[model samples]
Target chain A: MLLKTTLIRLLTTAVTLFGVAVVVFVLVRVAPGNPIAMMLPPGATEADIAALEALYGFDKSLPEQFVIWLGGVLQGDFGTSITLRRPVDELVLSRLPATLELSIMALVIAVALGTAIAVIGARRRGTATEVGLDLSSGAVLSVPDFLWGLVFVLLFGVLWPVLSISGRIDPQIEVDFTSNFYTFEGLLRGRLDVVQSTLSHMLMPALALALPLAAMIAQLLKQNLKEVLLQDYTTLARVRGFSETSVILREALRNALLPTLTLVGVQFTFLIGGTVIVERIFSYEGLGNMAIDAVINRDLPLIQGIVLLFAALFIVINLLVDLSYTLLNPRLRHG
Target chain B: MTGSQTHPNTLDVMQLNIALPNGHRLLRDVSLSLRPGEVRVLVGESGAGKSMIGKAVLGILPQNLKVTEGEILLEGQHLNAMTPWTRRKTVAQSAALIPQDPLTALNPARRIGPQITDPLVRIHGWSRTKARETALALLDRVHIRDPKRVMESYPHELSGGMRQRVLIAAAFAPSPRLIVADEPTTALDVTVQKQILRLIRELQQETATAVLFVTHDMGVVAKVSQQVTVLFAGKVMEDAPTERIFTDPRHPYTRALIAATPSYADLDRPFSPVPQALIAELQDDIVRDDARHQGGAR
Candidate 1:
């Protein structure tokens, strides 16, 4: 039954992704400037524009172009980028690491900070401490991610100069992928200085990205934990001599985790969208930057590939969230 | 009420009064004494504070509602004097509460075994394996068929009766000195109610645990209680042995309550008239008493 349900969910996700792909494809196409026109220089000849259109298959009928694009997409051919003159897949892959790293770090920070604040707020419910935390988190949440990024940039990058301004690493550092600076593999090699440098560079951008998500998650978790605290089982746990912390953490928090998991899944997807602003602010070479460049240069293949990648990421995250629901709640699993 | 001399086998409540924050007394200066191995039923109307008495004994009252001039002594030790942590441990080890809503009384998300074994682990420091064994044994004792399966099931998976039985097993897990069951079988069917009541009675007899059973049903009072305390709007209007209270109730409210109770012989007849005016008067008195107590405490 679990396997069947999971399969159904996966199939639904695939259908949803297909719908997203269609919408992205049409929306990107309907937007103002033609890619061939954008690619041409000022006062270019009609022959030059025509040759570029034919080369990029823009001269074909819309439906035919869509069919050819879709077919190539199914067979893993995402076409070539007009701006970079490289395969769209290669560009997406190269940029994916930085975004992925930043997102994972931000999610970690969000989960940790959000859960701590929520748990503290819930435990100190109706107190000034709780109220203060709640208000601050709410304030943080109301501000947009871009504004938060700018604020952090001003505070840390400009005002204090505690951290460097741009990129995943300092341009002066000549670190190999084999070393422990750029990748997870490198961090495991006991190279603390490289790891420290990488973290220091990533910290501000990650915090900027995570702050809003953390505040939102804290609000979500606080509500859930408060509700869980009122459950009879919590009372029973108390009467059974379980300490306040143990009851709250082990019983109430565990039960409350389902809703928080759903929120985390949503936040993760939003993180992908928010990455555009974060990457821009930090000058990080990620998919969001690639997508922006593609949009500016009117590179259709790059845009399509980035959109598809994002849709796929969203679908996978959503699937994982659904599966986690069953894992957290045994009743759902058995039922 | 005169204090009963402390004995090895009695749970005693002296001058127990529970006042709600709204200046309404749910349990007045009500007092009762139950011998170990004895079942004492507190019979009252829906809002007569019978459940409040149970909560007070368990020291699990809702936030901000003071005990207000009360002493709960279990075998001569003051329950209210102990630190909350110590009190909770003592309660878990020597006292258990079968809350009114059995379906909700157990944790919905947790399996039955761990919930039942929680006290064993927390109070007795039993290993998980030993606790599980004890839980299974207790489930069997409660006559739960397929104890292992029931142990593995969550509260929502079980029927109302099954959940009630699971709660009963959990309550009785610690071999408590006292058990305060607040409407233990109120949510179950008539047959299941009888079975649950029977299980409580059997457990009480075997464990020599004093049971302060709270219920609105006089029939349940007759079935389980040896002594009965009749409360109307929080005050103990009538207190007597169960047979005496049933046969010849002293208080007008007690008589009216008994009259209102549907009997098997009166299947064709409607319920007897309840004097709402008299109940209202008693409730007013309870409120007035509550105000006076609050003022006195201040």
Candidate 2:
């Protein structure tokens, strides 16, 4: 029964993804000026535009274009980027690692900071500690990611000069496997100094992106923990002589993780969107930077591919969230 | 009195008074003592402070409740004087509570075995294997048909009756000296209620564990209790052996309560409500007595 249900959900998700792809494709194509015109120069003749349009298959009907594009996508051909003149797969894959690293770091920071603040706030509910947590989380959420990035840049980059102001790494650093400096290739050589510098450079942007997400998660966890704390099992645990911290962490928090898990999944999707502005502010060469560049250059295939990647990510994340519900709740697993 | 046998008392609540934050007293100098192998039932109406007494004995009162004036002695030791930590280890070891709502009482996310063995591991420092063995035995004692299956099941998987039985098993896992069961079978069907009550009685007898059973149902009180304390508006109106109380209730409120109870013979007769005037009089008397007692104690 469980396997059947999971298969059904997967099939439904696939249909939903296809629907989303169709809508995004048509909406991007029909929004305004043609992709062919955007690629042409100012004094181009009608014949020149028509030839280019036919060459790129822009002259075909919308449905035909959709089928062709989807077929190519299914065949592992996402088409070539008009701006970079490179294959969309190569461009996306090249930027994928940097984006994943930044997102994973931001997520780790969010979970750790959010959980700590939430636990402390829950333990000291109705006290000054709770008030302080509420105020700070609210303040952090109010400040946008770009503003936060700029503030950190001003502090660490301008005032103290402890970190670089712009760009991912120092241009002067050489790419090698041994030397320790501020470059990714240098870290591949087991260079601890290079790893350190790269981490320092990424830290501010990562924090800038994580603060709002952390605040949102902390608010969710604190409320959930408080409600679970009032449950009878917590009382029973207390009467059973379990210490306060053990009951809170083992019993209360474990039950609270279900909601937090769902929230974290959603936050992950938001992080992709949030990183766009943060990347622009910090000039970090992540997927968000590539996305912005694609939009500016009106690279249709590149934009479509990135959107598809994000949608696929969202679908996988939701599936994992659904599966985790079974792991966290045994009743669901057995029943 | 001097030559009387020196039997060990499992629990002693002396001149206990509990007041709610709403300026109403829940328990009024209601004292009771349980011997090593006794089942004492606190029987009254829904708001008669029976469960309040149970909470006070276990030191698990909800927030906004104050003990006001009282002493709870467990195994001849002062429970009120011990620190919460020491009290948690020793006093809690001596007593456990089977709450009214078994569905919410056990952690839904946890397996039944771990929930039952938590106290054994935390308080007694038992190994996991030992705790598991004890938990299975307890499940068996509570008449769980398949102890192994029950151990693996979560609370949500069990029926209401099964969950209550599981809770009973957990309460008995530590072999506590006293078990305060507050309306354990109230949420089950009539047949399941009988089964739960019978299981509780049999387990108490086998373990020689004293039970402070709280219920509004006089039928349940008659079935399991050796002695009965009748509470009206948070005060003990009468205290005696169960048979004697059923046959010859001395307190007026106790008499009205018994008369109000539906029986097999009275099922055909139109159900009658206890007069509001009498309930009001009882409430006034309890308040007056509470104030007088408070003044005298102070």
Top-lDDT structure, candidate number: 2
CAPRI grade of model 1: medium
Off-target runs (Cα >4 Å) in candidate 1 are: A1-14, A37-43, A172-175, A178-183, A188-194, B1-10, B280-298
Those runs of model 2 whose alpha carbons end farther than 4 Å from true positions after fitting are A1-7, A31-68, A161-165, A169-195, B1-8, B269-272, B290-298
Model 1 error, position B135 (Å): 1.4
Tens-place lDDT per residue, model 1, A1-335, is: 87897788878877987787788878888989888777678899999988888998889888898889888888888889988999988788878877888888889999999999999999888789998999999899999887888898899988899997687777766666742226564477665666677688878888888999999989989999999888777887777777777888878987888889988998899987999988898887778988888888888889989998988888878878888898888778666
> Best candidate per TM-score, number?
1
Please provide, for model 2 over B43-94, each residue's C-alpha lDDT reduced to its tens digit, 9 standing for 90 to 100: 9888888998888777678878989888988888888998888887876678
Q: Each model's DockQ?
A: 0.55, 0.61
Q: How accurate is candidate 2 locally (lDDT)?
A: 0.84
Error of 2 at B219 (Å): 1.2
Q: Where does the lowest 10-residue lDDT sum fall in candidate 1 chain A?
A: A177-186
